[model samples]
Target: MTAPTPDTASLTSWVGDAVLAPSVHNAQPWLFRYERASGTLTLRADPARTMPHADPSGRGLHLGCGAALFNLRVAAADEGWEARVAARPDPADPALLARVSFVPGPDRDTLADLRPAVPRRHTSREPFGDEPVEEALLDGLRGAALAEGARLDFADDWRVRELLSALWDAGHAEELAPEVRAEIARWTAGVDDTATEGIPSYALGPRRYDGRAPVRDFPGAQRERDTAAVYESRPCLAVLGTHRDRPEDWLLAGQAMQRVLLQATLDGLSTSLSSQALEWPELRWLVRDPRSETAYPQIVIRVGYGPEIPATPRRPVDSVLTVE
Candidate 1:
């Protein structure tokens, strides 16, 4: 029996699922072009929305797009299509990130279990409980990252402390720089809930009472809050790295990140990202494992049970998706 070809309607649905993937500062810097006849979806970088200050080399942009690509693949599988992706297939068009071509494969069921986590996975900035993540679950997260051509390393007690210090130092540096603060301001929205993109002030989570958690300090504009909440004393931090630091490598790291995030969600874990230390070129080099500083650290993750986070906004599919 011949399998049915996916139409524009189905592709839109897949893109809808794909947009739910996380991006840095909610700066969803990606565009999707789907060709119905060839059943291929092309992912491109939205140059206009690139973060110049935080990600000068566009590493974060690629990572976030890579995450969206992973979601697209998972969504396609749920809709009964096998997605085969090729990175930067055309040299003439470097802006073209990846081209995912789909075909029918009965094995699509293998990833159907993860489809549920797509909606539930979020970046929770609040304090987490004392529950320790099991080694078995950590192993699954490593496997998930491996499946997408990236690495996830769990930081030891000492390493977590070092990372915390680095994050604190970097956050301080960011706070001091007017340009850096202004750069983030460009991507941060107020708590009014009118904007479709950027991190809203309400989703900033609770203010740090103990000053230990590695959450970013973007409370929108000049708003000041005296509110304070208890954060985890010893947070479980993990480093996501890639062997190469090229644009292509960043994209894979992003996919690996989302894969691990979804897996953690299924294991009943809440996750938040802390790339403050990784944003600065000087501090970013120190973020890797002391043993293997060669591995480029892409993002820092805080994992454990935490307060549920409200979903951040994303541009509608019609705005970011194009049909050909």
Candidate 2:
């Protein structure tokens, strides 16, 4: 018997799932095109959505698109299609981030397990409980990153403090810069529900009343009295890194990140991510531990059991995907 393959409808649904992957400031800077004749899906970066101030090198853009690629793979696996991805297949077309060709394989079940998490995984910005993540669960997260060609290192108390300080310093520095502030303003939709892309005010969680939680404070975020919540004092911070810093490395780190995030979700944990310190080259270098083999720190993640937060807005799949 011949096995089934995805049609245009299946590809469209998968692209919808792909866009759900989180992007910096919810900018959602990615595009997808499926070639029917070749049975290949191509991922591209949207130049109009690039963040010039925060992600000048396009590292964050690559990471976001990589995450979307991971989700697309998971979605395809759920439909029994094995996705083989080639990153930066064309040197001449740098914006063409990845090309994925699918085949039938037995391993589809493994990646398909994560399909349910695709919709449930949202960036929780509210305060988390004091419950410590179990060692076994942390170990699984470490393995998830490793499978995707990246590293996840849980910071010790002293290192967590250092990361906190770096985040604070970077946040203050970004606030002071007009260009950075302008970029934030452009991506954050304060109370505008009609906007398709950008961080909605409702998803901002709350203004951190106290504690060292790494929630970003978008300018003009709604600050009602009820919106101010106290965050966990001793937050569990982890640094996701790679051995080298390059566009391909960034993409790998992003896939690792989404894999970790999905696994953590399954473990019944809430999570949030911050790249404040990583936005600046000077601060980024300080994020990695001296003893760790991680050569470049890509993103900082906060994990715990926190209150349920709303999912941010994403552009319609039709707007971002082209079927040929």
Candidate 3:
């Protein structure tokens, strides 16, 4: 028997591409259901993989699911299928995050152009170079985010310093909170970790010796190998936002976040994510630029030219996907 191509809209193949999407703590908190009869895919938040304490509100989980949804759309388009996504189709079932149907067509948003970056994109925790992100690329990123129903605002110099200070406060506060600390400890892997999930030590990149690059300190307190390096003095930072703060908003922000990231990868830029400040209620509220109309900040992104980092592990498609 020959294997089906991705254009066939094979559940297994679409899930294969979807699993590569980034999630909080590598939690990959999502499950997919494909109906062969109607050629539709349903995305749901997998409670088993959700964080109770750190993400009691389930915002992080929603973001992870949304990222997967974005990947599924891109994969479908690149494979000659048009994907129409209906978010939260069932109002009562909040866990029913999104429903996507595959239609035969050669036209969709040219976002399929970023299909290659879907696999190449990784969250680089290493230090970025001093070179600034070009304005042309920045415009493209902004457009990508806007195309996905979200806002990406590049902070001004003063705003960057302010964001850095807030992130420092959030990280310090996380250290003092036993539950949050334990959450990170549980989600992060060690030097010799062999598990298929969670962030492994090898993908932790390096410790931030200097510079305010908001790479989440996945190491917790355990001593790791010496790989400290001073990050860039003035790292480029941007905030992904939505006009509202709700479960659906977070989900949309996640899709927008991945779109911008993929565009960055295509533009030859490495990226990292920092939601530390956004995890704290007060801090998350302040992370958004006061001048902007975007009231809610979902995630902070560090974009710049840097060395390519290794890919993180993801759960097997068979583990998170079901087709009937």
Candidate 4:
């Protein structure tokens, strides 16, 4: 496929669709610069958006940016152009994670189908109904993960519960660490409308003892003091994994995370993500099922039927996209 002619206007539209991707705390830790002369789009990480406490290594930030990158690929394909992508194209430029050159290719898929679910997918921290996700739907989710070079494992046994509990314990250990705790507090702006990034108060949901693995509450005392509506119970949980642990693997995992979430949204499923366990190195190892030797755990996703939470606000496209 030959590279497409540069079009500044069309590139801007593609960047707009790309930013609609979900990020941890809605940090949207990505910046795009498109060169009209070469039809190249550069993806860079915004260090300012990094979560110092919660994501010290910038793993979450990279993951968020990678998710946006995946969206960019889909968006370009939908625009009848093929995106030839290279991760970290320049060795000296650590911030520049990817460069995508547009080219002419078969326009078989429309990201417009995924577009509708872009805004529709929200982190449903609330509980889910007792019903199980259909096997076919689960398979579809697995396929979505594989397409991005990752794996998804569904946990449905007592042994899996034991492993999850251990990992959750390890995550709690990290949360208690002073440095990690400080970072989390710094990035987690309280439930206020004024804040641009971080988890919001309204989205926090109610805190109740469900006698099961629970989503981490970003809001500490403030959340406990407030009386919010009760969430459902017994939401389905799936673990996302990758075979190798590398920078590129992490990026691919992020893309798979967003793809699976968007697919779930399209399938009329509410989803939430818990990386607390995966955040702690000690706990991350425990999350890996003994049965799976080839794959390493990435993120834990909760899926089920639930109420449609309010959409989280995003920064304007002009702030993140630069056209030249």
Best model per lDDT: 2
Query: How large is the C-alpha RMSD of every model relative to the true structure?
Result: 2.1, 1.8, 3.1, 2.5
Which number leads on TM-score?
Answer: 2
69-142 in candidate 4: lDDT tens per residue? Answer: 77777777776777777887888988888888877758476444676676677887666776778999999999
Query: Model 3 compared with the native: what TM-score?
Result: 0.94
Candidate 1 vs candidate 4: which has greater TM-score? 1
Q: After superposition, how far is residue 256 of candidate 4 from its true place, in Å?
A: 1.2
Poorest stretch of ten by lDDT in candidate 3: 1-10
Residue-wise lDDT of candidate 3 within 97-192, one digit each (tens)?
988876665755596788899999998888899899899999999999999889999998999999998998997888788888777787784524
Cα deviation in Å at residue 291, candidate 4? Answer: 1.3
Task: Name the weakest run of 10 consecutive residues (lDDT summed) in model 2.
Answer: 219-228
Error of 1 at 147 (Å): 1.4
Question: How well does candidate 1 match the true structure in TM-score terms?
Answer: 0.94
Evaluate residue 231 in candidate 3 and report its C-alpha lDDT on the 0 to 100 scale: 89
Query: What TM-scores do the predictions have?
Result: 0.94, 0.96, 0.94, 0.91
lDDT for 131 (candidate 4): 79
Off by over 4 Å in 3: 1-9, 107-109, 191-193, 219-224
Candidate 1 stretches greater than 4 Å from native: 1-4, 189-191, 219-226, 292-294
